[model samples]
Target: MASQAMKITLERIALFQFTPTHCAQARAMLGWSVEELSREAGVSVEAIERFEAKREVLDVTRLTLAYRFEAEGLVFFPGFAPGRGMNVKGSTPNPMARADFAMVE
Candidate 1:
């Protein structure tokens, strides 16, 4: 039962998708550069650049990048709504955390 529950949780998490815009916004919000993100995500700088430019990346690469950003306190929202967006995970003084924004492209 526990294993099944874990599988279900993982499946739900796998459904979340982040766009190129989201990645850029989150990086900007955290004041991180592409090189920084690449190092943290364990992906090549070229991969990050390509993903940002094309908004498409391998599923595993996307997951790695997303998790890396999330680990840095950026929370990604995966829906098409005004309130669906990224923000810092906690109540920080960062202005971006207080903004309700989304990137659709």
Candidate 2:
């Protein structure tokens, strides 16, 4: 008997570019075996093995999956806060705004 073809999604496609280091973190942090990571991520064990054993980078298309991996709170890069570089979300405070306000024609 033949196996049915598997379907791939954009998110799954993005993880292809991930470095083996990233995948190893994901597996270790999530307490998952290679098979478990493959099942949860909808990727194949072969791909996971390639990354883990060979340390080869996955394809570029797989990069997008990094966010998804982060969403799981697995092994998103450390020291990277989503808003680290961006301004705070709340309204900005500036008492000097009114004092510095000047109308120029």
Candidate 3:
């Protein structure tokens, strides 16, 4: 049977783009295997493999992975930010929390 496509949600969207490096690093720090991550994130192991291999996957897959990591206290930062990377929670304050988003006129 053909598998169902992943669904997109607001949680999948974040201020920073989640990369394969982040996924690997977060998994390492959490001491989680791909299967463990799949169980936690409710994502497929194949999807996690594709993502960690730096292969293109669905947007929802990437987002879901990021969301799962973030929920586990992993912070993801984009490149170009000085001294920024996946960090454990409480190392630095969250710079772009959703509540911080405000419409500017």
Candidate 4:
């Protein structure tokens, strides 16, 4: 079985793929037109059109798509490593932590 995060990742990818009703759903949920989403997400309206029609998309755009949905949960896995998990907005911690250093007198 895949890890939970991996499973969620696959599920989101699927939702993004077969039947991108999610985009339409997102439009309805967010009250934005496809053109608006495309602009905010820095993608093309034609690309959004194609995504709605064909469910296929560029790897690079996947992150933007999640942002457009306000689906921060979907952003976690792809943008982050397995153990570290997601980062809350406005909080900047080093992804890789280190033990605090001390000086011996």
Candidate 5:
């Protein structure tokens, strides 16, 4: 059952992928600045800025951001409908202690 769910989640991720809006929203929810996210994700600030500005950026860069944020307890949903967005699982991220998020769609 869990594997099935993971498969569906992977499909959804592949279909819709990640967006700049999602990145900005997740970063805002986590109270992280571009510089903070750059340091955390090991992505350059210019790349982060370009991505957030909806400009062209490398797929690996975006994937790196998504993966890093996911590790920090953020779950991303890809769609325009209600409930199709990001949410922090378990609890909000804390600098002192990390939260856990499940990869299920």
Candidate 6:
């Protein structure tokens, strides 16, 4: 079951496209440098810079980068409708956290 799920994920990732802006945004949200992302994504810093500059990268490289970013809590939303973009999971305040804060106050 896990292998099947991973296969489906890989298939989806193969078809997904990421823009330079999305990469930049995700990096900024994580406060990660190009070198840092390169290390995590197992790609070269030069490749990351070129992708950001040209808004183009090989599908495998792009998927690698995306998966790396996602592993670090970044969620990528497909541009199927409005408000399509990346966001950091748990970056927003949760109700439980808010309640804890209220108790503290």
Clash count list over all predictions: 0, 10, 0, 0, 0, 0
* Local distance difference test, candidate 1: 0.59
Which window of 10 residues has the lowest lDDT sum in candidate 6? 96-105
TM-score of each: 0.61, 0.45, 0.61, 0.48, 0.62, 0.59
lDDT of 2 by residue, 26-52 (tens): 666667887776555555677667656
The reply for model 1, stretches above 4 Å from the true place, is 1-15, 79-105
Indicate the worst ten consecutive residues by lDDT in candidate 2. 96-105
Candidate 3 residue 47 Cα shift, in angstroms, is: 0.7
The candidate that achieves the highest lDDT relative to the unseen native structure = 5
- The whole-model lDDT of each prediction reads 0.59, 0.44, 0.61, 0.49, 0.64, 0.60
Each candidate: RMSD: 9.8, 20.2, 12.0, 13.6, 7.6, 12.4
How many steric overlaps does candidate 5 have? 0
lDDT tens digits by residue: candidate 6, 1-105: 999798667646533645666788888877889989876666778778977797555655665666566556556556621122355532222322222222210
lDDT of 5: 0.64
Q: For candidate 2, give the lDDT.
A: 0.44
Sort order, TM-score high to low: 5, 3, 1, 6, 4, 2
lDDT of 1 by residue, 1-105 (tens): 999798557635743656677777878877789988766556778878888897566655665666566556666566632122355442222322322211211
lDDT of 4 by residue, 1-105 (tens): 568688568546744442355556656555689878766666678777877786666644543554445432222232332122154331112211212111100
Task: Name the lDDT value of residue 68 in candidate 1.
Answer: 63
Query: Which clashing pairs does model 1 show?
Result: none
Model 3 stretches astray by more than 4 angstroms = 1-16, 80-105
